[model samples]
Target: MTDAPILIRSVEVLSDDWATLKKFTFDYRRRDGTLERQVRQTYDRGHGAVILPYDPERGTVLLVRQFRLPAYVSGHPGPLVEACAGLLDEDDPETCIRREAQEELGYRLRDTESVFHVFMSPGSVTERLMFFIARYSPDDRIGQGGGDRHEGEDIEVLEVSLEGALGMIDEGQIVDGKTIMLLQHLKLKGLMRASAHP
Candidate 1:
């Protein structure tokens, strides 16, 4: 068995905010009477959710393409195609995902199920992302959904076949990490089936 490290000292956070800088300090000890100290950094934390809506009969999936500043600044010149995703405010994970779907794609989801929850960048940020999956018919008419103009979101919804979507992943067209993880999960579970439209 390995020896457990001792906490010699620690620092606690009294308050934090979205735009405020924060820091944490920790002190530890080894079995040989040696002391060690480390400082961890954190930033404004947020939550995100990804939704994978599948149409079983059509073998298609709903995806959205949008402009992302992070991607654009990081060298990706083209828009990003990803599953419906958004930040969680004061609502539950499920509710946040449902609302994001409608706002981003104009699609209403039913019988949503949790796929997984992950931390996008735990080492430097406090963003927790929840992933979900739902079944929907592709034939359903989704009104124009481009997010709220006040929020500056202009999203384009796309319905592509499962094979095509997988191809996009292979071609690196779908570069969003959360979307990639959710698609992998669906493929692994063999739940990438199409639903019959009414």
Candidate 2:
């Protein structure tokens, strides 16, 4: 703890096609004062932002279904249900999520609440995601959102009741990490359920 915990020895580019992938050699200091050399490959796809837009009056939440190659490759038979999210190419977190909400969900975010920033996959992926939640009504929709066609995105928009969304989680229907987190957060906060129950 007294000295630097890690020391980088070398780095090599593994791939740079879509995102940057690099192999790193580093010296890691153990708790017992032993230094060990290790190698790790990291995929750098850049950080991103995700949002869950909820309609309190309707008790429903907006979501999307999209074809994720990685998920498909991992044995999922169909598109994954997920929150609206996008890589923060050049915009800040708030700006990134707002634009993503419009593009992927067709809803204009009026007031978004920042929840947290998390590394969904910290071991091999160097991408952090900012999480958010916001209120949306029927009037906020401004477009037919199916993601960017040029980007090969054919997203399906879904609006489900909050309780139904939770049931989907239990049934293993919604498996995306960010979506699960946001849904659970909303339920835990009792954002809409509290008033309904009382």
Candidate 3:
């Protein structure tokens, strides 16, 4: 609506349960000076934050495994291995990820580096995810993190070598997008070196 390329006509709420789902009707002006009517439905589950905690000294990283209904329905038969993430209900991105790290991975992060923000699924989902990376050591654990039981989260923490994680991706084990991005980022950035472990 703010740009001249599009004009919003109407927005209708389709569902208001767990998250808000809406149908948007608009007119899009093409580069050829033609107007086209478009209708799209977007699922709004709010934005979220995700963090990958890595130990450069050990050349290892922390991850979690949990059941995802969407992935299950999409033909994955088991729990998904992913980086720590949580929705930003009423907290900022850093605050939300810190809480998620404690609840999901049991690590008290000291310094966190903001990586980037992305729209994981911009086609239909109206959720923006903030990405981060933090250094973690063995001594950062404060509790047995398996997620909040009241939230029906039964997570399993994983500590694997950086190389092993990349192999998992090739083996179709770690298929989550955010997890893949963080792992690849760590590798591409050379944040951890082969000599780091020795």
Candidate 4:
């Protein structure tokens, strides 16, 4: 709270089962002369990185389908179609995404360009995500990646037309927030050509 509008009065650990959940008690000073105390719960699971691997030559994008318990409990019928992503465990965003590319997508990505960093769920989650886009070719395929089974990751790789991926969002087939953001970001940046095909 050095230069923040709020001062942290106290912090209590609410849960540490998987991610660390804490309850923060803070005193917020208004623009006037009023000071108010507020409490907020935040979950911290560390930052992560996600990349959309697109083949400009083939006009296709590499995605992954995986089962998410939260999505299932929240009422999704089955697994979700999403970009290749992983937590930046002990590495930087670039390195983390490179490793995830191989572990989840079976692609060997060399150079990557970052699009942006975002706080997906600011109100309740204390995690930041880095979004990236990288070009790929058919020769970059290295192995059959489906993620680590011991970690409960049963991933299925998908190679779909860029146009089809955009259409899936309209049809509710792709609902992952970060994935949607990355796809739209590319569209807005004029990187993906709707007519490009391989």
Candidate 5:
């Protein structure tokens, strides 16, 4: 994958209130030796990390339910279930995830395995997420994490059976993309299994 055939023309900042949104105009060389002018807008909310906490012995996964204004405005009934995640800010992906784990789920995960990296919304969002999974036990619980109140966060923690969680997906209850992907990853890798079902 080489970008030698592409040439950038200009970039304009459209909005920079809470996040940076920019419009880019560029020239692209087609396979037929033709140049094309294209324009696109991208919103950059910064990169982040997501972690799914699993307890294989009990076949359980930890998730969070929190209100998302965007989802609500887009027609969601209420809060959305999602993996514990946060923006990297200036920290590394691992560090950011660990921080978010403690802040969102009250678990201080000892070790985490990176699953993959993905752009959650590539078409209009310039944000990439590093996906990770960690094993946690009851002993890992630390604080009563519901997020910092001052940040306008009112998160509700959920401890769900893997089977039940998957059912939620089929039932349209678990609509968060990142959370769904991580849950499917666990099922694919045989990381967590419902003993009765299989």
Candidate 6:
């Protein structure tokens, strides 16, 4: 019925090696009958995929655990168990997800499929996240992957059955929003149900 808030102006650029920040000034019209102009703010951050690589035969999925400052500050008990995800650079979402999978989990995802794109924090942060799914096989020889040293990432990869992942979500072990959304999407689509019994 009512119009969404309008962005009158915006300025954005890549800040760090792989980070993009944007400043937005916008105006909104109130319901009663008032024109309110304000300099609202949002970040057009490029968040990559949370790949839930499923093995139809094995009924397994890959998950990752890592410390997140925002989650901690928001009253989460500890670090989060999530899917392999990161920010996209100038590259497309597919490229970003592939790089993150290898860097964070020591897993190479082939035939990556785009699931959907979502806004992680639409209310405040303009972070557009792309979700993807890929198939991968276990490799015992895969070396430790905790992301690049320069990026200061210490990640631990986990191979769990889809049922186990669902349990983690139910127990609140997976606190990341993107991860939750992806899992829910898979559940709703009946993809996880075929292989994973919960």
Each candidate's number of clashing pairs is 6, 0, 0, 0, 0, 0
Model 4 agreement with the true structure over 121-149: per-residue lDDT tens digits: 99999899999999998899999999988
Candidates by TM-score, descending order: 3, 2, 5, 4, 1, 6
- Worst-scoring 10-residue span by lDDT in model 2: 189-198
Model 5, residue 153: what's the lDDT?
82
Error of 3 at 131 (Å): 0.2
Per-residue error at 124 for model 5, in Å?
A: 1.3
- Please list the residue runs of candidate 4 whose C-alpha ends up more than 4 Å from where it truly belongs after superposition: 1-3, 195-198
Predict model 3's lDDT versus the native.
0.94
The positional error of residue 32 in candidate 5, measured at the CA in angstroms, is 2.1
TM-score for candidate 6, please give it.
Answer: 0.81
Each prediction's RMSD over C-alphas, in Å, is 4.2, 2.5, 1.8, 1.8, 2.4, 4.1
Candidate 3, residue 104: lDDT: 95
The prediction achieving the highest TM-score against the true structure is 3
lDDT of 2 by residue, 1-198 (tens): 237999999999989988999999999999899999999999999999999999887788999999999899999999999999999999999999999999899889989999999999999999999999999988999998999999999999998888888889999999998999999999999886422311
lDDT of 3 by residue, 1-198 (tens): 356888989999999999999999999988888889999999999999999999998899999999999999999999999999999999999999999999999889989999999999999999999999999999999988999999999999998889989989999999999999999999999998563331
Expressed as tens digits, the lDDT of each residue in 1-198 for candidate 1 is: 124564424455645664334667756565676767777767655677789898766677888999999899999999999899887888899999889888888888888999788888888777888889998874444667777778899888888877777778899889888888877777788876653321
Quote the lDDT for 72 in model 4: 98
Q: Give the distance in Å from residue 150's predicted Cα in candidate 1 to where it truly belongs.
A: 0.8
TM-score of structure candidate 4: 0.94
Quantify how close model 6 is to the true structure by its C-alpha RMSD in Å.
4.1
Return the top candidate by lDDT. 3
Q: What's the lDDT for all of these models?
A: 0.79, 0.91, 0.94, 0.91, 0.91, 0.74
Model 1 bad stretches (over 4 Å): 1-20, 29-34, 139-142, 194-198
Off by over 4 Å in 2: 194-198
In model 4, the clashing pairs are none
Residue-level error in angstroms, candidate 3, position 58 = 0.4
